[model samples]
Target: MHSKTASSSLSTSSRIVLPNDTNVLGNLMGGQLLNWMDITSAIAAHRHCGRVVVTAAVNNVSFNHPIALGDIVTIEAKVTRAFTSSMEVFMDVYVEHRLTGEKKKCNEAIYTFVAVDQNGKSIDVPELIPESEEEKSRYDAALRRRQLSLILAGRMNANEATELKALFEQ
Candidate 1:
């Protein structure tokens, strides 16, 4: 498989939060933001694999702040790690106030995707090379996250999670 840098697959999307995108409290709906995050992360996976990819799991998501109507919502995503046929994507969401030009982080999410062939079978993806310090950190942590996810899904036993075991042994 080919080796690709995380920056090569970086994706960013922005949308204006309209009235319809907000709830009765005038804040952007969590579902709507999740949908945006999913799409943005999917783009990053696609760019990395250059093959058809499908969302296998949404590992984690946090709605840290409210985004109001008229705010500009920006979502950034990049591939953090690639293993076999699956890749982990990390996304950060930010909102910019319309009037004050101030920006704040609103959400963060992690999504896992698997590359697939025409017949819907899993296909191997490229290795992700992390460049920046932050990217390297995320890349290293992906193993622990994957182990935890597998354990929680009952696909793997906690005792088999070597990376995760090391964390608590420290």
Candidate 2:
């Protein structure tokens, strides 16, 4: 399979935080943000592989700040790395003040998706070629993150996770 650059899989989306999308406190609901993240990341994965994709795991998600109702929420996602059948996507969420026009990062997440056929069986995905310095950094870190996740899930022995072990050794 031919390798594709990170930019080729970049996906961006924006949504208004309507009243229905908010909590009682008038802030965007965490679940709503998660749903948007999933959709945005899946788009990136699909673009990277040009195949049907399924959410395999949500590796990490952090809510740094609260997003108020009426704010413009922007989500940017890109494929950071691709393995045999899965790809890692990094998503950043920003909230823009309608009046001030200021954008602030409110959340970030990492998700994993596996390419699948119509029958739902996992399929191979193309390699991701990171072009920018930031992309390269995320690409390099993906290996360590994968090893740690596997170890935590009990699918891989900690002793065998060289990439993750290196982090503790340093």
Candidate 3:
């Protein structure tokens, strides 16, 4: 039950959906959305760790709605937790309608990153610094999600795991 001694935050990143960013369905492609998430999350992680960081895993990514072509996708990322050399980054993607300005949450992702030295060797990240109560809550929530993911992964047999995994699908 490790907890952060402090917390960190990074600026938001955004991308405009271009014609090529969409698929045959005229919705934004998952890969393009994932690339936005990964890059923004990495930037947040590096800002927190103050060094180069490499993604260790995208623990989870879930898309809740279709992002239509020309939608502006905004990704907000923050460091939710840190352990030794690794940090967990939580990102939420918002889609704003190009004309009406209506906004909806389209995706959420959790990514783990490992800080690295100039040699590309892993290095310990600074203790997370939580600057606000909200940030602290987000950190705690991330921990709970991690624990739930582990529990679901460990306890479920293949068939059950597959069923539960289906619930996480787009």
- Point out the worst 10-residue segment of candidate 1 by lDDT: 62-71
Cα displacement (Å) at residue 162, model 2: 0.5
The per-model lDDT (C-alpha) reads 0.94, 0.93, 0.79
lDDT of 1 by residue, 25-119 (tens): 99999999989988999999999999999998889998878888999999999999999999999998888999999998877899999999999
What TM-score would each prediction reach against the true structure?
A: 0.97, 0.97, 0.79
Those runs of model 3 whose alpha carbons end farther than 4 Å from true positions after fitting are 1-8, 145-170
TM-score for candidate 3, residues paired by index: 0.79
Q: Compared with the true structure, what per-residue lDDT tens digits does model 3 show for residues 17-47? A: 9999899989999999888888999988887
Model 1 gets an lDDT of 0.94
Identify the superior model by lDDT, candidate 1 or candidate 3: 1
Show the lowest summed lDDT stretch of 10 residues, model 3: 1-10
